[model samples]
Target: MKSLTAGAEIDAWCTKCRMDLMHRIVAMVQSAPKRVICLTCNSEHNYRAPRTETTASGVHVRARNTGPKPSPAAARVTQKARAEKERADSWSSKTLGQAVDAFTRYAMDKSFREGELVLHSKFGEGYVDKVLEGAKISIMFRDGARTLAHRAN
Candidate 1:
């Protein structure tokens, strides 16, 4: 039985290279193979031998396979979704009155209370109570209740 010391280099078999090659000592355990790593393959596996300190250039170099890496289709979809969201956020660039008009029409399907703060893209913030006849919409403000013509665009 041999004692394994730190920074020792040893000869070990590399499964990747299918050959016995030199490896630098990285770690060790009591009564175990010195945890040899292959210099050529740069792989670490348990070995029964202690290693010695050797430079990575001292080992025989093997040709690495230069295969094409696969493209990620999922990553492309994520990038496109992010770009679309940025474009949609520019809707705030519209006039406040136009924005209010748009939001009011959109909120037609939703209900509002009497004193609740409602944002009218054009008129800004106002309170709502009831709906009147024709295209006229009622909004209660700090001044009083005022009716505005609602137009759909």
Candidate 2:
């Protein structure tokens, strides 16, 4: 058996090149390459092996999703993204002209509560998700979540 170590040359499916390319091992765990940098394009990503699943007929079936399921935080982020998209779609139906007046104006020196929709002068419309200490609040806008200051005094 050959020893696989960092800096070792290996073959990996390059995400950038979209083909099997020679790579330099960037990280190794228990003699297995976990991360590699493609020598062809210098792109770094997890090393992926040819994925196959055996069926009852003993045929190697190509796997669809080879990686593990998304983590909880990632799932939450995805959910938040979906919710934001739904909100955006509903926003358009709510009439942007009048909707802008519906959203409470956001003020830096004012107070806000969670679930309160505020219209940011620059960030467009967003809803407060959390209120933190020091007058900082996490608000979800069209772009994404952001922490801003409020109630300076």
Local distance difference test, each candidate? 0.55, 0.78
Q: Which residues of candidate 2, in runs, are more than 4 Å off? A: 1-98
* Model 2 RMSD vs true structure: 14.8
Return the top candidate by lDDT: 2
For 45-73, candidate 1 gives per-residue lDDT tens digits of: 76633223232333423224343654588
| Model 1: lDDT of residue 91 | 28
Which runs of model 1 end up more than 4 angstroms from their true locations? Answer: 1-3, 48-153
